[model samples]
Target: MAKSTSGLSRKRMGEMYRTMLRIRRFEETADDMYMAGKVVGGVHVSIGQEACSAGVCAALREDDAVLTTHRGHGHSIAKGTRLPEMLAELMGKVTGLCRSKGGSMHIADVSKGHYGAHSIVGANMPMAAGIGLAYQLEGKDRVAVVFFGDGASNNGAFHEAMNLCAIWKLPVVFFCENNQYAVSVPAEYSTSVDDISVRSKGYDAPGLTVDGMDVAAVYEASREAVAHARRGLGPSLVEAKTYRFFGHSRGDPHYGMYRTKEEWEGWKGRDPLIVCEKMLKMTAKQKKAHADAVETEIREAIEFAENSPEPEESVALEDIFA
Candidate 1:
């Protein structure tokens, strides 16, 4: 492994590797649970793209706000949400975040500064701007980070929010996890631009593209973006070129449906976990021990979620305003 030019401490690099491993293991467990019918509804696992969430969130402070899309379990975990509660929420149990109302798509922990994950396409972009506005009005140094997909980047909301954020000099970072496909459609077919970061030019903000499979690359880019926002330099766009190992959702037959096995294997070859492990120069034994520790933690989370009681049927109507 070459010496890290990113200047990250050995401890921090190890921590990043552990964090990515946790996200990978958690999503793998969730996929198994979903297949076994334990987790109801659909789940959008961020399997291969864990580095984006973990690296970006690593650059954020505890008080910094984050808004993510439906495929957000990784982002939630990276942003400091409790694993057990998040799993319980996915299971629709009473002990879950939002008391089981939000389910997988809407998991949130305001205390952790994660506003919530949205199911609507591109909905949170403007909301992130609003959160940044609130922080600005409050005269705080906090910044808002919004994660969206390549598909959402084409939506009007993304453009509108970026314009607003740029004009107002709002402290926000628009992190686009461009995993190639917007559901069944590839970015090549759906998007006009090669890199989503190019859209920032129209809004008069800085734009950067990073190799999302490299955790160190993502962390460095995010650190710069976060610093730019915190310094009141306004918003910036970071487009992470990555891939999702799973289907658009758990139900989709990812292979041969829209993508090929060869393509899948190509991305898997660049798996962030593998990349980081090589960078850290972890021995086989050390890798196994690290993986074992993450597995144990995930097992505990699964147990906690299983042991939790289901939400009462009647209470579903209670939390609703309409």
Candidate 2:
């Protein structure tokens, strides 16, 4: 689908494209399944923010821990979480990542350094600090990345964790996906600063805000932040300015409720997948081929989930407590 490029090899660029597309297709299908009652619980799809997760995780190693928010499927997939396990978790199958317990808002695979995801806004913030502290005390070079939204930045944990990580020089990359809204509330209405990354200045940490729609841009910026942390330079805040094509959640209106049609249309023009294709100069045939592969993978995941067994009623409460 791509030819060799100078900055990033054509192969890696193509991989990123496919990853973004994978996220888009996966979320879309998951949402559909949720509505159809095949999938359990509330589904929050990161359809338009694929570039943010794809690019940031591309800059990370498998051993680096990732702590993400409720809308975390994109980040989990980006970290190489298996599609079957993810779907199983969504479907509440025993073969799921968290053994049918965590579901969509809570999935964790420690073997791959994906610590866990939280439904509470900003909940992962302090956990990111704790994980970073653990790595520091252990003298491990591995870093922790906490993916939060613009809403979480306003949470108290954001301030505490950022301050503590900065003061201690902990290895952490604070990745913020500022998608313009926190539920139905506009970020402009709730946030005091125009750019959330600017808040990093208060803690004397390196901060950068990039275009979340451009996978290449997000990757480059994330690589820089990751490098700074690996060098024991402490936490770095990397914010991606992006948008979500879907509503805040299920039953939420896609338009006329909070976002203007013009705003949504403008963002749609720069959809991450479209941007990736344009940048790579992929042919229509190549685009169609990539899409087919993504669809096939997703279908297989669903099939596996449906066929998998559910957790036994006997052991359902066994893993409830730590």
Candidate 3:
């Protein structure tokens, strides 16, 4: 993408573009694997919402913590989680992030400062707040970032976490990836507010909304939000108005049933990758080069997962608490 004059450097913009492309390709490969019976369990792909995760995570430090929702593969990838391990986890291989136990929804890589991806809606919000509290007590400048959907914004956990984070002046950023759907229900039908960021006001926290499809916009907003938190100014909420180009999950067959074909086409026309390509004025050769590199990486990851051995059956009960 074209480097914003005052914001991201050209190199950083290039990194963002590559990161977004990697997320898109990774999800696409995972979808194909799921359909071919290689990947088991529920698979939620953030195909169209890559920019939000890429931009937000790009603005964070390596030691900063992050909590993500069920649809968090892109988030983990953006936060430095390895693609091979993530894909292996989805395929139930022993080489997976959680030794194939967490599947698609529960991948966690604490080494990268990614707390974990939770399957439960709105569950990670409070967990992120607790992480923030810990950082505060330890006198660290680290910040906690939580990624949730518009649906989760209406959940009680979201309300409670926002209140506590604000009250304690905890360094946290509540990033609501408003993809406009809570499963089959539309946000317009489910949420009373037009913008999810408005809810931040009730907690006395700063709130802002950005065009999630635009990576630069997201990056700018997130940088400011993260900086505010790092300065010990408390929490902020960023509502990214974006769209998912697929069904809520792989198992959900009603992909285009709820929304109109025109709506889908309109959003796809603004595909984040395409937009970034335009901004960068990338040539066909450059685009092909980028695509080829990402495809090779993804193919190698899949091969690694397929070649990895499964966990021994004897160890199945080892991690259980019961």
Candidate 4:
């Protein structure tokens, strides 16, 4: 795991690595809990695609906003959502980020700038467009990023949102986490566009693609794209072509039922954590120490989430509207 020392500070690089590791471990823990029948509902783990989330999020300001997909925990974690609250939301606890109402698909912390995660494909793109519009009208420089899959790129909202964002020069970044599939369907089947990034031109926006497995590459790409939007240069589309080592949700096996064995093995070999570790000039002991500390922190968060009480029966009737 070699650190891209070109343009990042020590603290920034370290934070990026830490965020990637956090996302990886969080999804791993969620997977284990789901298998043990502790976690409820469906979870779209972003195991193999952590670099896309961490890289892009690393470039965002605290005030910038983001919208996520069902496989959104990575973005939430990267955007600074506290783990205990997130886990509690997954467990349906009263203190959960979404107050135990949104569950896995809808878990969001508005205060953290994570607008919300939706299960409906391509639904959030338009919402993100509207949010960007609000920011522009309010005279705020803040930008919004939308995380979606390749299948979502084909949806009508994707086109409509991009059109609106480009028309008004809204500060938005369309981040397509092209993890090769939309659930069980492959991108090849869903799209005729050779590259998702090229589709950005249709909306008169800049489009770029990066190695989604490489966190450094993603961070660099997003930094520039976000900077462009912040300069009021209009929007950009980034296609992070990564892979998923897990199923669409917790119930499916990692071994691909729809994909080939060779494809899975190929992507697994380039594990983001391994790549990051190799780049850093640290001894195995130091690497282990860092990983252990993070694991301990996550363990504590999980414990807190588990011990926390579930939502009160009376809460079921509250927070339904503004």
Top-lDDT candidate index: 1
Worst 10 residues of 1 by lDDT: 1-10
Model 2, C-alpha of 319: deviation from truth (Å): 1.1
Predicted structure 1: lDDT: 0.91
TM-score for each model: 0.96, 0.96, 0.96, 0.96
Tell me the tens digit of each residue's lDDT in model 2 across 1-322: 1112229877888999999989888898889889889887778899899999999999999999998878999998999888989999998899999888778999888888998889999989999999999999999898999999999999999999999999999999999999999999999999999899999999999888888888888998888899999999999998899999999888787778999999999999999999889888999999999999998999999899999998899766686678
User: Model 3, 77-185: lDDT tens per residue?
Assistant: 9999999999999999988999988899998999999999999999999999999999999998999999999999999999999999999999999999999999989
lDDT of each residue in 15-116, candidate 1, tens digit only: 888889999888888888888888867789999999999899999999999999999999999999999999998887899998877788998989999999
Better of 1 and 4 by lDDT: 1
Q: Root-mean-square deviation of each candidate, in angstroms? A: 2.1, 2.8, 2.2, 2.1
lDDT digits (tens) for residues 187-235 of candidate 4: 9988988689999889888898888888888898898889988888778
Reference-based lDDT, residue 263, model 3: 86
Off by over 4 Å in 1: 1-5
Candidate 4 global TM-score? 0.96
List the global CA lDDT of all models.
Answer: 0.91, 0.90, 0.90, 0.87
Predicted structure 1, TM vs. truth: 0.96
